[model samples]
Target: MRKTRAVLVSAAVVLGATLTIGATPAHAETLAGVFREHSECERVGTRGTDQGWWDDYSCEWEGRYRYYFLYA
Candidate 1:
């Protein structure tokens, strides 16, 4: 009764704090890596002109399709 309730509350608190400490740092590290890659691209002239989310290699072949499109 009372002992079970106290145990449950303590367990919940511990789990929540553990999750928070583990997840937040990973998210922050990912964000920092993205920013670093973006800045590196800016420094160079390799900015991919494509804006689609699933175009894996479309950026590097920007102008190559114009001639080949007539054959397709």
Candidate 2:
């Protein structure tokens, strides 16, 4: 009975792990460097989206640069 319980628990754990991993959402890729101007950042982002390099992008001005986050 103990062995059966252990097997059931192990199977449950494996199944749970598989489901969790499979259910994970896709993560986006980001720009490697920061942009000095918002216009520059938006320009690159727009080009990327228009040319099919990325699905979409959003620019955020933070600190000294405009950070471009790209999503596939």
Candidate 3:
């Protein structure tokens, strides 16, 4: 019975560590959307945080459009 319990605990620890490693983001930021207006981009990025999809966001201009990025 002790051996069986030890094996079960070891398996649980391994599974948890795997999940933690897999859940982390490999990159700092990823593009969420692009908009023609700055306000619109900010609005959408704000909504994303409010909805709990992203922790934080930033915007940048490329050409005539604004790009939105969400970072973990």
TM-score of each: 0.37, 0.64, 0.52
Question: In order, how many clashes per candidate?
Answer: 0, 0, 0
Model 1: per-residue lDDT, tens digit, 1-72?
999999999999999999887875522211111222333433232233243322122112225432211100
Per-candidate RMSD, Å = 13.4, 3.2, 6.4
Best by lDDT, which number?
A: 3
Q: What local lDDT score does residue 7 receive in model 2, on the 0 to 100 scale?
A: 100
Residue 19, model 3, lDDT: 95
Candidate 3 backbone collisions, by pair: none
Candidate 3 ranges with C-alpha deviation above 4 Å: 1-27, 64-72
Best by TM-score: 2
Give me the overall lDDT of model 2: 0.71
Of candidate 1, the 10-residue stretch with the lowest lDDT total is 27-36
Clashing pairs in 1: none
Candidate 2 segments whose C-alpha is farther than 4 A from its true place: 21-23, 26-33, 64-72
Tens digit per residue, CA lDDT, model 2, 1-72: 999999999999999999998884566456634576677778877888889887867776575433543333
lDDT of each: 0.38, 0.71, 0.77
